[model samples]
Structure formats: structure tokens, C-alpha cells
Target chain A: MVAHPTRDRRAERREATRAEILDAAWELARIHGLAGISLREVARRIGIQPPTLYWYFDSKNAIYDAMFAEANRQLLQLIAEQEWPTEPREMLRMAARVWVAFSTEDVARYQLMFQRSIPDFEPSPEAYAVALEILQTMRVDFAAAGISDPAHLDLWTAVVAGLAAQQTSNQPGGDRWLRLTDEAADMFADHVLGTTTQESQR
Target chain B: MVAHPTRDRRAERREATRAEILDAAWELARIHGLAGISLREVARRIGIQPPTLYWYFDSKNAIYDAMFAEANRQLLQLIAEQEWPTEPREMLRMAARVWVAFSTEDVARYQLMFQRSIPDFEPSPEAYAVALEILQTMRVDFAAAGISDPAHLDLWTAVVAGLAAQQTSNQPGGDRWLRLTDEAADMFADHVLGTTTQESQR
Candidate 1:
């Protein structure tokens, strides 16, 4: 079948409008934090009336859902492209650095995806699947280190997430917590996987 | 100077009014979240006009400051009353459990203190002093466990706080992260303190 030029043009316009609205939302969110996003302000920034904004997205929440999914997709893409270390300890260090950088590099994105900053906002199921994939990667990292229990996964998330939280909250642009990534990873490997590693070495 | 009965009564009333205002604020916070708290709604709940509410507290931010201090003071008291285990590994478990409970028991209080939830609200120095005391206690516990480096202190905080954040935000009323506190503490002991303990035992 021949491609329809007008339909393609219309589709391109629609996609561009969505990207425009999302870009405006990201800007507003960075300035005011994720919870500060206002659809009216977003529409105003886009030079569209609120009704026109609604035509593209049904509600402020729909835009948030899109943003969450997009951020997750971006994160998944980043993880896919990056090479994880084969060594268990180095792998955790790399993973920790990635988690901290991923969170600290984008404050609003971190808040939306990790923190309960937004009220009555649940990421769409598709978005959550992406998040699950991110978590699955962590489990794989833990298992590679021979720390594969569910408890270990939970502990690892807490350990790394805690570092990210401290960096973001207590000292943004500072390595107050980020500085500990490698040492923490070493401690994790030593304590959580040390006995196993030692026994295997024996 | 001798205390006058009427003056004493007036001071009592003032203290009671401050408590009343804070209580009202907490109720509103629980219902609408920390950011949802409004001076008008707080005043309305307490049967006072918004301006009249200012007699006890200067502003909504002032109320938040008081709540932050009060929560910190309460946590300090809780830490004081609780007995931490003397055994190095068990001590960490105690510390992690205490930290998790302190946070998960009151989500609003935890958010206010640990998270940069309110944009403009800064806790007064007096309250911050109380918060420092709590952190100081963690160092003491770390010392007791034979881990004294500042990096270990930073990592321990991350490990425990991450668990609390997961419990509060990701899975409240669940032990998903809480269950890992002991294991995490053991990891801390092994990696951060294990060698020291072994050396001391010799």
C-alpha cells in the first residue's frame, strides 16, 4: 500500500505537539519540583488554551503518566546501552554509580519515579513494567554477586536508594552520599557475598 | 521571683494553644498530606479564624518548623528510652529497626524531617540541634559496633533510611524492606566492622 502523505503529516504534527507539551512540563517541573506542575501553566507555556491542551491530553494526570513512562523508558534505554562489569564487586559499584547518577542527574524525574512526592498519582501499568525491568536488573546484579535472596535484593535497593535519597535531599551537587558508592559496594560484596566468595576461593 | 497563679495559668494556656494548633495541623496533614496543609483549614479545624491562629503560630511555615522540631525532639526521646543491643551485629539490627519504626510510624513527620518536602520551610536551629543529637547517637552506636569512619556512618544512614523510604513509600504495612534491616545491619557489621571485631577478639 502507498503511504498516505497527509495522514503522515497529521501524525507528525500530533507527535510534535505531544513532545512540545511534555517539554514544557519538564521545564516547569524542574523549576517548581514535580508537585509544582500546573497544566494551565503548561498550556500557557505552549501557547495553547487549556481546552486545546485537554484535546491533546485528557488531564494533568495523563501528562504525568506519560512523563513517568517516558522517564522509565529513557532509564531502561540507558541501562541497556551501558556495559555492566563481570566482576561482582565492580558490578555493584557500577550499578550503584548508575543509580546515584540516574537519580541525582534529574531531580524531578527521581521524585516522580521513586519518591511519593505526587498525590493520587500512580504510574500507568506500562510505566510500572519498565520500572519492574529496572528492578529485575538489580536482582540480576545481586545474583551475579551470589547474593540472590529476595531479602538481599530488598536490602540492596534500600542501601543504594538510601544513598541516592541522601544525595538528593541532604546534599544535591555534593557527593555527601555519592562518595560512598564504591566503598558501600565493597562492604556489600564483602558482607553479603564475602562468605560465599571466600568459600569459593578456598 | 515568686510565680503568680494568674501568670502561670496564662503560660499554661499559651502552651496548650500551641499544642492545639499543632494537633490540628497534623490532622490536616494526615488527611491531605504535608503539602496539603493550609492555615485556613488548620484554623477551621481548631475553631479559630486564620488570623487568630497566627497568635499562637506566626505562619504555616512556622507551624511546619514547630512540627519538625517537635518530631525531632520526640525521636530523640524515643532513642533515649530505647535500649540498643551491645552485641555489634545485634546493635545494628536494633538501630535499623528503631530507624525504620521511627520513620514508618509517622509518615508526615518522617517526610518533614528526612525529605525536602516543603520548599520554603526550614527547621529552626534549636530543632536542628535536636536532630543532630539523633545523628550523634548513630555515631555512638557505630562506635560501639567498632566502626568509626565517617564513610561508614554515611553508608549506614543510607542503608537504614533506604529501608524506611521503601517501607513508607513503596510498601507500607509490609515488611518488604523492613525484613532486610537485620541482614543489612549484618552486612554493615561484616564489611565495615568485621575485621575490627576479629582483630579485637584476638
Candidate 2:
């Protein structure tokens, strides 16, 4: 049942070409948005005849699926690397800083994950699982930091998500926005760690 | 030097026509992303020839400007009517609820404010003034609630804007997202008002 050597080489080459096309499409979408892109345009960018694109991927959605999955995977990896703090307030602060820094540093990648319009598109189960894993990690981290109420984890995630979205849009008052978010993270942490009274008195 | 009566009447009608066109365009942009719309399509929806649209508004940008102004005006009016809470935490919670409800109810209008793409479009001075006034009111309210840091006001605005953007897009984890937002608001309020410690201990 071993594959022929020529067939294996051809498959590897095709896979490499598909990856190249997807990478180009991802860059184009970041600048022009998902709605304005087309298969012909993607092929042109990849220096291939438009019809040749079909040989590697079925449709634009498939390429998007690949790019989206890659972007989400990268983000989840970044989140996983954050150091969870021993203090509740510090823990939330670290998470907030990491989230904001990741979004601001990689604007195009961040938009693909959160901001684009793709109607009637469902993520592959693997992509969804990766996204969920990131969220779950944050929840476990919060609990370990002494956040007794499971509900607070959800709120923190939303706040963090919201902060990322605002920061990436180049919205007005950007610095102030981040500062406020840091303060919020601090507050949430203190509440979780039962240090609010001491912190408040200061 | 008085204008002719007919001239004045024509001018009044022109203003009314422009307003009507803007209203229609705003609704249309909501269903179709701003980039997906065209002046011709908007005119057709309003029962007019495409060229006739230019008689009142010069371009889609002009129409968008008008619609943006109107939406901001409505938001300001809504915020103005709400009584300010004396406690900082309460104030944030109240603001969060109002902001979320406004977005959830008039999603199209909300998206027009925060998510629309406007290349090289500087908001008109009048629009800027209106937006400034809205932020000023929030700042004053925050000050009154003893949350004197100007940065916190900006963060609250970003969080609210972020939440609105998420809700408008119909992102996954609907109920969970909302509940998380509510908790974030409460935690933010406690932090700002120096109440988190006292409340959590109780």
C-alpha cells in the first residue's frame, strides 16, 4: 500500500503551493478585507493561472478556512505562553497585557481572527477546539489565581476581547483605553484574591 | 435681499430629501456592509434614479456622514436622559447596560458608528463636536461618581464599544458573552469606586 515516489513528491509540491497561495491571500485580506478578494486575484498574486487555483483548493472559503485556522492557532499559542501570576490582580494584569500586546503588534492577524465578515462560514472542528482550548486555559488560570466565582472568568474574557478589538481598530484614545483596561485587570485580580480591601485603602 | 418664496421652499424640500436619503442609506448599510452598497442601489431602494441621489448628497461618503451624525445624535440623547448613578461601580454598570441595549436594539446604527470603513474621511467638525460632547458627559459623570481618573473613562468607553461590536456581529457564546460583560462592568465599578474589597468580603 506504499505510495509511488513520484506521486508522493507531487502531493508534497501541491501542498506547498497551496500553503503559498493561502499565505498571500491572508496578507491581501488584511489590507482589503475578506469581501473584496477573489480567486482570480489570489491566483494573480500567486503568479498562477486562475484555473490552476482549483487544483489545490476548492474555493476561496477553503483558503480562508486555512488562514483562519492558522491565525487562531498562532493566537492560542501566544496565550499559552503567558506566565500566570501568583497574585490575582497581577494574574489578570499579565493576561490583559499579553492580550493587548498580541493584538496591537499583529493587527492584520488579529483582524482575521476577530473582525472580518464571513457570512455562513463555520470553523472546522479543529479550529473551534483550538479557540475553546485558549478560553479554557484562561478560565483555569483565573481559578488557580483564587477567582472563586466561575462567572468572573467569562466577564474577564469578554473585557479582554473587547479591549483587543478596540485597540486594533486604531480607535481614538488608544493609550487611555489600554490604561483603563490595565486598571480593570488590577481591580478584577484584587477582587479575586481577596486583596481589594487592602488595595482600596491605599 | 430677501430670498424668493419659491427658492426657500425648494431649499426646504432639498433638506428633507437629503434626510430621507440618509435614513434609507443607513438602514441599507446595516444589512450589507458599507463597502457592499452603492449610491445607485440606495437611490433605487428610495424610489429615485441613481443620478438624482447626487442632487441632494454628493457621494456615498456624504450620505454616510449624515447618517453617522444622526446616529451619534440619537446616542447622545439616550445617554443624556439616563440619570447618573452616585457610585462609580453603579455608574459603569448602568452605562454598560445602556450601551449594550442600544447596540443590541439598533445594531445597524451601532455598526455605522464603530465598525464602518472610511478611508481618508475626517469626521466633520460638527460630528467631532457631537462625539466630544458625549465623551465629556461621561467624563463629568465619572468625576461626579468620584472616579477622577480621566483614563478610566476612556477604558469604559472602549470596553463598551468593544462589547457593542461583538454583539452587533452575532458572535458565538451569546448568553455567555453578555453575562461576562455584566460581571466585568461590576468588577470595573468596584475597582473605580473602591468598593470591590468591601463587597467581595461581605
Candidate 3:
């Protein structure tokens, strides 16, 4: 059956509007945190009445779901697009760099995916599936690089998640935290891949 | 200088009350979350007028600082008291267990120390000194185990910190996240000790 031109246009408009609302919500949530956000606040930021947002999103949680999915998608895309090195040490370094860069660039997005608690909210199956895909990719790459231990994978994932979470917290000093994070990442890479370098040379 | 008996009693009572307030704040913060808490709410929960809270803490940030210091002190004490194993692998495993267990038991306290932001607060010179001592101990142990790289210290710290942070955020039906953390910790231990176990065999 041929779709009507008016219906197709309405569908496109609806999608665009949804994206606009989500973008607004993401920015507001970042500034005020997850608890500080509401549908009315998001709509106000986007220059629309609060109820108009309901047309596109069923509720604030719906918007959160969409925002989270988008953020995860972006992170996975960053990892996917990297040109990984063949050496195990270099591969590990590349993974750390990608992970840190993605997290630093999208602090709010990262928080939504990992930090905040949203009551009664279940991420769409697709989101969890994609997250697993990212983890699996890391697992496969690490294994191919001769990291055949299950324990190593567990540690790697935990450390990576920890660093990501740390980026979102209200730590005391910004410069110190950044230095610590970079130093920590470098150390983690060495531990995982056993790279030989002056810094690694105790 | 000799103090009066009544003065001594009052001073002791004040110290005890302050400890009670800090303990209550830590518990409430954990349940309601850091951002969700207010000074008034904390005071109310402790059965004191909000203004009276100032008799002990100058502000909520001050309370947070005390809580953070207390948590760090406990963690450092736990780390200091740990008995190193004869084998490097066993030592690493023990360290991971102790770190995870400490953070798990006092999750709110851990969050206060590492997870939340406190503006205008710096780690006291004493706290900084103790933190360095803990790192030094870790470095010395790793070196003795033939893991000569000092970088491993940073990686291990990040791994432990990350695991603590993630476990705090894990929710009901978050079995996948929990399993991932456990696996990650095991992998980290193997990476540190240069040993592979059956779990890593897969």
C-alpha cells in the first residue's frame, strides 16, 4: 500500500520534534542533574508548552530512555570507528584512549547511561543488547591480543566502568582529578598489556 | 592546663553528638542519594532543629567533609591491617576482596568519600599523607611479587575504585551488571599476578 504524502510528512515532523525535545532534556539534565529535570522544564527550554512534549514523549521517563539510547549509540560508534593497533599493549592503549575520550566528551550522556538511578525504568532491550555488544567487542579484542584470562576481562570492564563513573562525580579538584584519571588509565593499560616504558619502568 | 570536671564532660558529650550526626548523615545520604539530601532534612531526621545543627557542623559541606575523612580513615586502616599472602596472586586476590568488602559494607560512606562533589574542599594534608602511604604499601608489595612496574599501582587503584562505585549503583534485577563486576574483579587479579584461572580459560 502506498503511504499518503501527508502522513509521511507528519511522521518525519514527529521524529524531528522528538529529537529536539531529547536534546533539550539532555542539556537541562546535565546542568541540574537527573533529579532536577522535568518535562515542563525541558519544554520550556525548547520554547514549547509542557503538554506539547507529551505528543512526542509519553512521559519524562520516555525522554530519558531515548536520551540514554542515543548516548550509548554514540559511545559504541566511537569505539567501532577506531583503528586498533595489532600489538596487545598498543591495542590496550587504544581502548583506554577511546574510552576516556568518549566519556570526557559526553559527560552527561555517560552519567545517564551509568550513573543515575531511574525508578521503574527499564532500558529497551536494544539498549542492553548494544551495551553487551560493546563489552563483547572489548572481550574479543582483548582475547585476540593474548589476554585469555576471564579474570582480566572482568577487571578491565570494572576499571573502565569505575573511571567512567568517577568522571561524573563531584570530586574536590578538577585538575587533580583529570591528572589522576589519566595516570590511572595509563597504569591500567600497563597492567593489562605489560608495556615496557620509562613510566612503566619503576 | 587543668580543665574543670564539668567542662570535660560537656566536651566529651559534644564529640559524641557530632559522631552521631555524622553517622546519621551518612546513612540518610546513602538511602536518599547525595543530591537528594538537605541540611534541614538531615537535622529533622536527627531530631534537632536545623539551626541547632550549626552547633556541630558549619554547613552541609562541612558534614560531608567529616564523613569523607572518616570513610577514608576506615579504608586506610583496613588496608594497613591486611596481611600479605606468600604468593603474588593470593596477595592480589586478598587486596581485591578487602577493598570490595569495605566499600560494599559502607557504600554510603564510600560514596561520600569518592562519588559526590564537595566544592572548596581539599584533601587535608594528613589525609593526603595517609593516601600516599596506602599507595606506597601497594607499590612495595607488587614489587616484592616480581611485578616491578609502578604503573600497576595506578591501575589497581582505579580497578578497586571503579568496582566500589559500580557496585553502589547496581540495582535490583541488575544481575548482569553485578556479574560483570565480579568477573571484572577476577580478571584484574589475574592481570596483576600474571596467572590465569579456569574462569579465564573460557
RMSD of each: 2.6, 4.3, 6.9
Instruction: Assess the local accuracy of residue A7 in candidate 3 as a C-alpha lDDT between 0 and 100.
Output: 61
Candidate 2 lDDT tens digits, B1-202: 9656646877788888888788777766666755556787788887999999877877767777787788889889999899876655667788888887776566556655665354434567887688778778877777777777766765676667666666555453255455555666876666666654446535
Evaluate all candidate structures by whole-model CA lDDT and list the values in order: 0.84, 0.69, 0.67
lDDT string for model 3 (A1-202, tens) is 9756656877887899898888888787667655557788888887999899888888777777887788878878988888998766667667766785576555566666776555446677876777778778878888888787765665565667666555556432232233455455455566656656435535
The TM-score of chain B in candidate 3 is 0.76
Looking at model 1, the pairs that clash are none
TM accuracy, model 1? 0.92
Query: For residues A8-125, could you state the per-residue lDDT of candidate 1 as single tens digits?
Result: 8877899999999999999998888888888889989989887898888888889999999889988888888888877677788888888888988888988888988887788888
Across all models, the iRMS values in order are 1.0, 2.7, 4.3
**Candidates 1 and 2, the one with greater DockQ:** 1
lDDT of 2 at B44: 84
Q: Is the docking of candidate 2 incorrect, acceptable, medium or high quality?
A: acceptable
Candidate 1 lDDT over B79-155, as tens digits, reads: 89987778777777788788888888888888899998887778888879989998888788778767798877888
Better-scoring candidate (lDDT), 1 or 3 = 1
Ranking by TM-score: 1, 2, 3
What does the lDDT read for residue B106 in candidate 3?
Answer: 62
Q: Model 1 segments beyond 4 Å from truth? A: A1-3, A140-145, A195-202, B1-3, B195-199
Using lDDT, rank the candidates from best to worst.
1, 2, 3
